[model samples]
Target chain A: MAESHAHTLDEVRAAKSRALAVFEPLAAVVGVGITRIGDGYGLKVNLREPPPSDTRLPTEVDGVPVRLEVVGQPRKQ
Target chain B: MQLDSARGLKRALIETVLTPFVSVGPQVKILAVPAGPVAGVSPVQPSIAVGIGRKAGHEFQIAVRCQRRELMTGKEVEQIRRKAKNEVDVRYIGPVSKRAAPWTQLRHRPLQIGISTGHVKVTAGTLGAFVRKRGGTDPHILSNNHVLANENRAKTGDAIIQAGTYDGGADPADRIAALAGMARLRKTEPNAVDAAIGKLDDALEFDPRTIRGLGKLAGLGAAFVDEGTEVAKLGRTTGLTRGRVTAFELDNVVVTFDIGPLRFDGQIEIEGADDGPFSRGGDSGSLIVEANTRLAVALLFAGTEAGGENDQGLTYANPLRSVLDALKVDLVAE
Candidate 1:
């Protein structure tokens, strides 16, 4: 059987089913360069190998633009 | 020797022996007209000579028989007319090169051979061998003139069996196309005769990227060689090889001796040093391509013959489009 990642789209909805307001980790955020080659996302992160956990706001970490989001979970330790 | 039947044709015959470029043939003829204008026929450019004899003979006898050709154009013909009273006749010029028509029609099947042990298989010699279509028929191989001519020994349909590569790669000659006209016994003046094409078949499929790059023929470019410009080729004896563009175009060749051939257009030669800058011996038929663009630029052609006789190991090549126009075919590998 093929192993499935709970991080799948369905799991995301289940995790936030009842949450009306919450904060989530800014996973990916990129910006647009003048040349605009590929889409410029404000931020991007790898859950498999997350960057050193941060507790900062409006961060410019790892060349990615970040902003806070609502997630109802405590940034999984 | 009589003034008419046996004139200086004997001496001219001797000169032809020394210079293959101008030889006497059965159809050879020369025309003589007074530098003075003729009354009826428009006085044409001084008399001309055509068709040279290959063997030794008297010069006087030869002057009477060859037709002279016009500048670069093999069309215009000037025939001999009795010289007017006391008027000196002018000498005529001959054709750029002598060639024989090919007998057998070309075979478009892929030529296969092993570059490692000269092994023979039923496939094109190796990968990267240009698989092209012949006159819109079967697929063929594209290489340099030096390669398929096999040092000028073989002709069209001469069954180019498999041979290993310059390294351990496949043999390039396997996929070579047989040339028709303009290629006979290899001449020397226009030093580079490097380009040659082959025909491929339907059964064989190839990756255009790996085989040959398809692009528009550059009408004009920097003309200067750009460093790091990638290039690739499929040679007759050497198979396929790649390199970087080294320098700018150099002309006005200061020829030292009669080294059989002169230009190194697609020879993959770089700056100065002679001795086939990169490929040697059988690598004569390969194509030179710019690295990323894969633009077919040069056609690999001649190198030094025996004795390293022409010590200037410089190789020669012909530009690519000339190859296409000369062969009257298109690059099917785009």
Candidate 2:
């Protein structure tokens, strides 16, 4: 993936805002931000652990794709 | 013919004997072994034996007994013999190698960045960079509060040491600076940075703007950049590593501290570029910079062991602008 974006920075920010509003309250979620998805941009949701098998997360937010990453707890290096 | 008669002739012979095998790789060692009864050499004749060995990976010892004899070509061996004008016995011996050591863990005079350093009461951390209070003349050592200030437990005049206590640095002996200031880490509120500085001691000398391998800082980098922007860092534990910005404006990054877990917002996230981790324990306070420009990017403070795609873990850093603004300091760019 590259930093060059198909979507404007504003689009990514708006998408991030929507992702945060939806994912921030979840106990499993740790962080939310904009990330590169293939050749384009998307909202990245960092989870403390994998969500339930039956759990459903949006694949896209406001036309931007959503990528879920299972990043365990971050600690001071 | 006296072997020691001409220094130039001796140097030429040595160069000729070793030149052809230079491309043979670092695993091969050419030494002058004592003349002894060996195949193709007379028992009474003193001969030059070229011993080629293989290196045991990551070990200090070499396996001189190499089963791959074809590594030494007959043409190269003949060239060495022809250069010496004497019988040269070229053979593969047991492996022999020297382990590479990390120099950043050692104490150095005129302290350099990317070395083991921390508060006298703390175990160890990295000396990230050098800076000065805005409009100030004196230089300061920059690092995490957990490093130079013992996580807010230390006072302004507390001693800071190089090589750190965990690396055997002691109070009054390895001391190089005094704590100047820190961006206090709050327990209940979100924090923007985990940084602090130490007023450099008058007696010691230090390079105010250079990193060990990355060269001098060009200047500060943008706090917000694209996710895939490449970056690099030099630190105590990991030495130097390359990584790519995986996430930006990362918020709610909960970092476990000595006091407790604290939430950080608008942080930068990095993932190792080539399957290795970008940073590890004891690497806190490392300065992250643009891989191509060497522009200061961020102050690395936290990381995760797993959950990244590369399996090498993820690193978290505070934007350099936030760190400097919080501490009221500027990079000593000169």
Candidate 3:
């Protein structure tokens, strides 16, 4: 089995921070998180709704792709 | 399943099914697993998880936490499984209840943190910790708002007792502080804390340095708790208990109070030591601190319980920094 190289937790966090800094001001952004992707890591930008085509979030940061995720009203539990 | 779609399904299930069941039977939690392991079986199917707690247990396994499996029959389990409609796998885990219960006949001295303190009108809860108003000489006692204020039922200068009203502390014999301030809790909004402070009486011989079990006062950790950070607490019900922070940065956690259901965000959840629970009722006010440095971290509040011999339960708390900031107080340091 081949070992897959992955971004360290710190690196993933930095990418997330950069993504949040850019998209957090947008009205659609609700929260941002870092999660493991196939072999590296990706930034998950939570949105209030599906992002429009003109959303400011980039395709990648620090070699990590940014994934747009939509969230809803908070759950009770 | 995608996280977005999974959350939507969770919302629907809770609104239509779990909420009604919980309203009738308070000892259950419905968990939605978009994808995860269950009882060592990693089923790819998006499942609805139900944890039915009976008696408290030593091992806090989430797969099936029943105190006595015999208490829950095979028929009842099948009935629940049948109702799922095959859209999701219904996973049932019966472990012990982690609810904290009130202490019985425990004696505590005055002016000590980690002892009982509650509104004169209600059962006793822990004193939690002590603090001072920023730039002020007066010392204040910290605890849950439910303890000191009786869930907003108490007014300014309401009497607070050392041993809690449940332990027979009344009037001049036990009164030690007066309610000062509290953070308002909202039902639907994201609340950061359930906290209050009491002004210690000038006449009482109070010592803010020593906790009942963990002696000497220390500073607090303002940073967020990472997963598996070692923590401990001293309380009236269980004296001293230790655990590890299982998870944090949690949002939308619904905790039931006597007033009603309130949702909290950015909360920390602790899994207790193998021997027993880290806290119980009457321990709600206990200060959760880092075990080694004694760095005050979280304020112990709610736990779930079942009728068992161990009486162990998982404990939830508000971050110490949030509590302090919300109440505009600072931890008293040596």
State which candidate has the highest lDDT: 2
Model 2 lDDT per residue over B197-217, tens place: 999999688865677777777
The CAPRI quality class of candidate 1 comes to incorrect
- Between candidates 2 and 3, the one scoring higher on lDDT is 2
When candidate 3 is compared with the true two-chain complex, its DockQ is 0.06
The per-model DockQ list reads: 0.01, 0.36, 0.06
Report lDDT (CA) for all predictions: 0.33, 0.75, 0.63
Q: At residue B66, what lDDT does model 1 achieve?
A: 27
TM-score of chain B of each: 0.41, 0.70, 0.66
Candidate 3 residue-wise lDDT, B1-334, digit = tens: 3344445645554565444344453323222110111123222211234432222332221122223355244443344434433233333355445354433224455466677667787567778777888888788999988778877778999888766666657866788889999997777687889889999888676666675566666788867686668888877667778888654554444566756767776677676766676666567778888887888999987764421124354567889999999988998866
Instruction: Report the candidate with higher DockQ, 1 versus 3.
Output: 3
> After superposition, which runs of candidate 2 have C-alpha atoms over 4 Å from their true positions?
A1-5, A25-27, B1-101
Tell me the tens digit of each residue's lDDT in model 1 across B66-116: 234342232221212222111223344443342331111112233322121
Candidate with best TM-score: 2
